[model samples]
Target: MDKYKQYFLKNIRKKLEEWETVPSISHNEVYRFLHSIAGTASIIGFDEIGSKARKLMNQLNETDDKQWTIEEVKQYLFEIIEWFDENKKDAPVSFTDKGNKYGDKPVILLIDDDTSFLMYMKEQLEKVGWYVAAIANPQKAITSFYDVRPDCVVIDIHMKETDGFAVLEFLKEKLKQQFIPTIMVSVDSSKAVRIKSYEMGADDFIQKPFDLDEFIVRVKRQLERKKHIDEMLLLDELTHVYNRKYLKQAYALLQSDWQRSQEPFCLAVLDLDHFKQVNDRYGHLVGDVVLREFARFLKQGTRVSDIIVRFGGEEFVILFPKTRREEASEVVNRLREQFECHSFREGGTAFSRTFSCGVVEITDANEPLEHWLRLADNALYEAKENGRNRVVSATPSQEAVHQKIIKIAVVDDDPIMRTIITDIVTKLPCERKTKHELQTFKDGVEFIASNWHREHSPCLVILDGVMPKMDGLEVLQWIRQQKRSDRYKVIMLTSRRSENDIARALELGADDYITKPFKLLELEARICQMMKRMS
Candidate 1:
């Protein structure tokens, strides 16, 4: 024990035990006492004690004078006090704090059937500050990749459950869209394997039994490149606000949060009034300056929670998350007034320009983005008609925008898998022209028994191959025999080593086949692609 150990233990023990005998303590007092211990214990070399003290301190709710009973205090600090009693005789063996477990490190999805190698690689990666999601079964590659959303993927070429090629093939679409780095690994460093892997959309290739440092360097290199690509893909070049591509995605996520929490959010369309006049009088270069200054003004003027995007020339969109329509409208009005007062100087031409804004609260979770845009656009047109520099809040229409609602059926016996797919579907970037309707069934019989298949609207069925009381193949056959012409798109989810079943599924009119333990992004991409095909 350090010379300070006795002093530390005497003070910590007395402070903690005081809670047990005292009738109560103020929340602020308890917080201050824990803070004192946390700060002092670590400095004196009782690191664990300090760490634990901080954890207990975090549990305290801040208040001016709220009282906490002994029971409530003990609930949080029992471990801290107990540690002091047990460790009075000995200090915790000198230790190192290896950071919070996988704290914000780049996540890597590693697929290898070799358990020993997987464990070793995972340990090595974690040691170097990489979070590795290692899966032995290739079947789980799909599900884990989708759920984990790893920054990189390292997959072994050889596996009994499913080969690395199949995983790569399914993940190809996602890799193209996201540019997620994928590394193919194998004992064979043959040229053919390397070529084949690259052809399958593998971003990098590594031979097994290679130097660990080299492997990490290669993975890090790809991650660096991906970061650059991500920045380029997400932001507008001139305005530096989010681009149009990002708006649809952000809107979908906002809708998802609204559906879950019912928290209010508003969508607004903003156009600089008479922007063309500025561009014509001044050159395009001057026009660029006005746009950049406008974006800067909006960013500086609005709350950080609001999202500003350059929705294409002179047109900008802002998402006021967690703000009601009335409040957002007021904010937009304030911004409009503030912007009108600002002057843009292009070579001593000091001219002031005003903007027109149309804002609407997102009321319907099911409304397509265009519906919201149209509502805001109509209001924007009204603002232009009324006056150039003004803000307008659109009245909610009772009539809902109608689109083809494609039934997305997940017929899986496993409830967990069903829930995962259903959840992921909410995040899928579907074609704006069509909205999706999701349904889940336990077995093939249950799915077929329902009138979903008989619905007049186009339907996409994600049918599982194996199920009790009528399997996926049987369901596929029944779907094919239906009187409705190819309005139905079915993606068969088959188990591993189902070659005959795969062939049979295709023969029975399955639109696509994905082996089980599928990657999530692949499934989402497949669904999105098949949806396009159906349209």
Candidate 2:
């Protein structure tokens, strides 16, 4: 495929050279040539070239046959020709990961309107183990900032859709109380641009076409500072885990994720049993020691994805993402047994301590984020009432499972993608043991305006990011302004691999985001996983 692109580019160059040697040419001929190239480039997945060709074609008269000088022809095709000549030596675009797993890496949000620059910069950043969320649309940058919570931000000043300063200004205001590092980048190296960037709250400013190594190092420096800031503000001083101050933000993040995927989680509240007696018998210093040791124990007992927060005094809260109630209960019971068997020693004195816990799974996803914690607290009260050293499970909602109508919407301009998604939605009913009413729309506008889409039922949207009318992101943002629930899920199906695009979709309330050319089995598994937590 790469060789084919190279061959075509070489053919284009040959054509251009042949035209230049000729005495004259017709405007209509040039238009026809550009039209052919536009279609061919698009077919070959060279979207940038296709777009350039189309734009140039619009300036040419299809019926003009007057002789055009070689100079005039060169001037007409100058920009695209220069672009082609410059990028001809570059490697083909790669969708493969190059064996680099960036899923767990520090995310850097790069906002630039140049598609080629976005692609190049993203690959370069990923090579250094940082995940780059390239936002080609500057208008979408601000909305994505909070969702991705990037360690570093890089914004290009010049853009077609929106001003980088405006985007930066919005984000700076949103993060005025926070310490996320933001860097402004532009081809302009003037003192004014630099000073204005800093004035707009940019932590750093770099000129475009600068050393890639230097850019990455500056990003690393910013991330290091962010880490230090997190240690001081986000972590509990004694336990080193998250503190109560960060719990509300964490809960909001978790709730946003749940709204996107209907993925369930468990919240557990734990209290040291007979903690007052411990302070009376062993003194405050020993009690503090026990608290610290118990925090370490809790951390060891839970998975890395789980969060433990020191709520207050001897009380601690645990949040388990994507965990079921029963599984969370079992984990808490095991941890309690192990903790009870451990001996706490101060000098020659030794004693055993126990903790009571309550675990609750979010059965109603639409409830307030604090509702889960409150339920878990109630269960903890039950644990204390029954036995001081035991884990009690919160009774789940007793609503009977009745036959319900699940509306499934597949919105994509591409017929093949729509067919694939509709098929998947069709299969989900049998696999999930539920009934589904499915609908397909070839355009975002059609789907949004359709009567079927307005039906009052639990809906699952398999939306394409790129569409003819309203884009998938726009539709997603619109849908999110309405409602959310355990039965409502929106999985974004897009060909865009940009993390900024993904974040914007999520920040706008998308339940899930799937890139193009994804495996059928993997998508099916994800849907299954989310569905199991729904009801």
Candidate 3:
């Protein structure tokens, strides 16, 4: 045994001898001596000495000092001192305090009845960049959970006040949403003890006399697991952008910032042009590559403060805090141009794709998120109708700009088709008309039911054929049957298989037709032609 261990044992033996000589020892003195022996013996791995000391303390608790006989007390003390003499285990080297190694180190809450062991562990852990709060009482450890918010907890399973399982349950209950990883250490190595600890929310269990290196590794592992789990919840696995869940959380935080300053921020929704066709043409694996590259470009193009989220599939949403609508428009339009110019290659074959965006500014905190999203969606739809590869502003310019607002309607049964055409329309530029009004519908019946003819009649209608109720043909026939069929300008969208349908619609007075999967630029050219003819 080390000299310090031998010295401690001799001091304990001296105290016991003093008790033997006294006619009757007080309960307080018995407790003081037994508690010291229990703490020191446990630290030095003298298990029998620690257990015997605890039993003597328990005996002291059961009766007052007047009831105890001198013979009985001396007999108990003799066994404890003799056991310590026979045990030959050396005390581990005491941990030396190395002051403040880390600036913001992880906090560890260590709870044990043994004060000596608690102090030793605290010193060792502090040397390895851990801020340990050592609590000798289990009751105090339970109450400290809120204050510490520790990264990890180390508890001795056999505590005087309460067991480690009770402490684990208390911590788990208090930390409902997140928890501090707990390690329960005990001299008992039975299977039942480990199983009960795990069932009670213990992250790990260590037998007494554990290697310091192994203990540190287990603590580090739990901390790493917590970090990785947090990241997984916030990040998109495929695109590495923030997912929708994170976006919602960020919005709540940003909303608080907006409430303080009332500063305007822009929300933009982006959709790639003909993304479905890309997947169909080059398989889903190539489609994944395209989406990843697209997200990378978005991140590279935007400012660091901007929040980019892969909303779902090929659609994404960007939030530009403390930016005006016009500034956001300029930023996104520049990116849109870059996207148009870049080529995506797969298997030695090159393909190009473009995305359209709708930008809206939130100037009022009273406006709900859903309303803002709707306005952005409307602008995006208009971009698709006018032309793809463009940016449109939902926040209209000041009236002093003298910009005429164009009204356009898209009637398509296919939701994806509606989104595509709206994105195209949003890109249309009218230096004369700075903002455009756009509406979309699933079927022709709903469009006609709106009775848009009188006050806010659309200047152009991009109608889809082969709809469920009231197809594009029926809508055209209804328009022709009216008194002024020429008053409405219509561009029909049809598939290659619907050539006969297009012919019939043309004879029925449809203005023009574009085949499905048509080039976005081609659609823009046809819109220009229709505008010229109408003028």
For all predictions, the C-alpha RMSD in Å is 22.2, 17.3, 33.3
Q: Which stretches in model 3 have alpha-carbon errors above 4 Å?
A: 1-232, 396-535
Question: Candidate order by lDDT, highest to lowest?
Answer: 1, 2, 3
Per-residue alpha-carbon lDDT of model 2 for 19-118, expressed as tens digits?
9788998766677567656544643456678678878876766567688898988888887788788867873663322332213467778887776677
lDDT of 1 by residue, 84-158 (tens): 779877755433333432134576788877766765686588667665666666764664354456678888898
lDDT, residue 141, model 1: 62
Better of 1 and 3 by lDDT: 1
| The candidate that achieves the highest lDDT relative to the unseen native structure | 1
**TM-score leaderboard ranking:** 2, 1, 3
Best by TM-score: 2
Q: lDDT, candidate 2, residue 55? A: 80
TM-score of each: 0.35, 0.39, 0.34
Per-residue alpha-carbon lDDT of candidate 3 for residues 27-144, written as tens digits (9 for 90 to 100): 6556656655654454344556767776776566623445345676667677775675565355445432223321246767787777557646765886676666666667656644
CA lDDT, candidate 3, residue 254: 76
